[model samples]
Target: MTEPAWKSPTDARAEFRGGLRVPTAGWCAGWTQANLIAVPRALAYDMLLYAQRNPRPCPVLDVSDPGVVSTRLFGGDLRTDLPAYRIFERGELVGEVADARAVWRDDLVAFLIGCSFTFEAALAEAGVTLRHQEMGVNVPMYRTSLRTLPAGRLGGPLVVSMRPVPASLVATAVKVTARYPAVHGAPVHVGDPRTIGVTDLDAPDFGDPVEVRPGELPVFWACGVTPQAAVMESKPDFAIGHAPGHMGITDARDSEYLVP
Candidate 1:
């Protein structure tokens, strides 16, 4: 694995805060990465309930009070620390920006959701190759046919990220990831992408698609991007989220979310 440019979560956030935008998959080594989603306070309860009902794809790490820019989990500014942000209005994506300070609202409540990238270090240690990281691209993500249980006005199809795992290491990948339940643990589906309504692996709804080698099986994990999907489908009046592959690196350690 290539060495990351920055070593600590704080350093990584500094790079992002300075307007550097890139997928965060291998950025902060053992530190945990989080998905950012901020919505109006009026919709906060519904967002919380939605995560409660769909814990697999929407695992909650830390939630900021309305208009709060930082949380215990994240020490940096929420509006400017992440690599990229997506702005939504009435569920339609309107802008992708390097900084969200201009669009941030005082009434907004931000949720820091667990990301699968937190476990990539564990997967690599276990000898499971992460194709996207190996190829220097964002992990491929797809919207599935499976619908999440609704909460108030929030409901949408489940979104999943795919990693091509060698046929022999598939079980190892599952075992290693299953230990990190807080980060969407285990493979929700393992073999055929079509089983989950994904017809073409080459064309992904978000992030760059990776090559599935001859001896590999495309493994899928529930993605934190699911909330963005919800925002797009449910059409909340206003929403802000991390760009598909870009994420918020948190101060929390990956070991904190590891299961016994």
Candidate 2:
């Protein structure tokens, strides 16, 4: 399948800022994608501690100073660059918007968390089929029975994105992804969805569900969405996050996170 027209991270950010809303999975192929979570300065420490404690699902790439939008990894305006943003009030999702400037606050500190999508290019190059990309839908993500380690006021069940990998290519997918440890490398669980308390693959906690072919197994990976889940369950007064599958495209290349 041909990739999206926006090959550069700057182009993708500009398009998103211009109100082009779409899941970012295949947008900037070799560029790294990140999960955005902005919270009050008072809560930033707790959030950072939570991520450090639960590195699998919350590997942090960069964090902004209070109210800052641009970071070394991302140069676009955080409030308007991502395709979609979710605004939360006391842990309730109050709104999802194309631009977050209206709800953004001066005391908010943003975090750019590592996303599993960063390693997808490597997987595709290795011949592992990406069903969600082919189907033109966001990856399916679930809130699993596994719980994350708590830090201060942040904690919740782990969130995972599921992909159906052909049984034959599962090993290859694992090997290719494992090289990018900063991007939630490798599958956390494979096979039975029920094993992880995901009773229905079609009904996910976040994003769209795709078909798990007969010869394919449902593989799960630690998702950056876990922080958003924590914001919900932990009752943070205010928070902003990228709408499930809609991520922030970073200027950094995928190779920057790959290990030799």
- Top-lDDT structure, candidate number: 1
**Candidate 1, residue 213: how far the Cα is off, in Å:** 0.6
Q: Write the per-residue lDDT of candidate 1 for residues 1-260, one digit (tens) a residue.
A: 32563568887888889988999898878899999989999999999999999999999999999867999999999999999999999999999999999999999999999999999999999998888998999999999999999999999999999999999999999999999999999989999999999999999999998999999999999999999999999999999999988999999999999998
Show model 2 residue runs off by greater than 4 Å.
1-6
On the 0 to 100 scale, the lDDT of residue 132 in model 1 is 93
Candidate 1 regions exceeding 4 Å error are 1-6
C-alpha TM-score for every candidate: 0.98, 0.98
In candidate 1, clashing pairs total 0
